[model samples]
Target: MIGGKGEQKTLRLVARHADIWHSFVRPHELPHKLDVIERWAEREQRDTSGLVISNELGHRGEDHADDLYDAGVRLFTLAFHGPDWDYDLVRRWLRWRDAKNA
Candidate 1:
């Protein structure tokens, strides 16, 4: 996987060598970042149709998943911290994902 926060060099590398690209970029910036990746892929003569876009949904998983999906993210990873964490968020996201898949 190629991981970066919308860096041009990183995107270029992704275009050249990756099947997956992961990042934590905000929803508002996702389109532009994708465009950059497309441009880089074009330059590298790579077909980006097989590229899988992934987003690390830090603390904003519940808030941004839908928007990120709309913006082209196909895979998601949630952030969990501490020993007292709750699984409710995971259940909710799972439900949402199920509904989307359905």
Candidate 2:
């Protein structure tokens, strides 16, 4: 389940009830967020191994990819957004992601 701002409380509540803890967070702030999650787990004495942390990365750049990976982001959803909604743009991103993974 994806959660937004002011959603952390709901996220924590849902995290306990659900299988995933999905949210949008900047790469630079990920470590601190993860630390917060770790602390929350420690306090709740909850085994957080089953919880998944997912992030939305609009474009996959080397530095961003590395930062996200280092921050324990396992799932990434790339987006294509603008004044014009174009499938071609999304296709291009998929191609890029595929080549990078390759």
Best by lDDT: 1
lDDT per residue, candidate 2, 4-80, as tens digits?
42335754564355456565777787666656666667767777777677877665565776677677777767776
Residue 1 in model 1: lDDT:
95
Which residue pairs clash within candidate 1?
Answer: none
TM-score of every model?
A: 0.87, 0.62
Q: Tens digits of per-residue lDDT for model 1 on 32-94?
A: 888888899999999988999999766675557888888888899877776977788778778
- The parts of candidate 2 lying over 4 Å away from their true place are 5-11, 59-66, 78-85
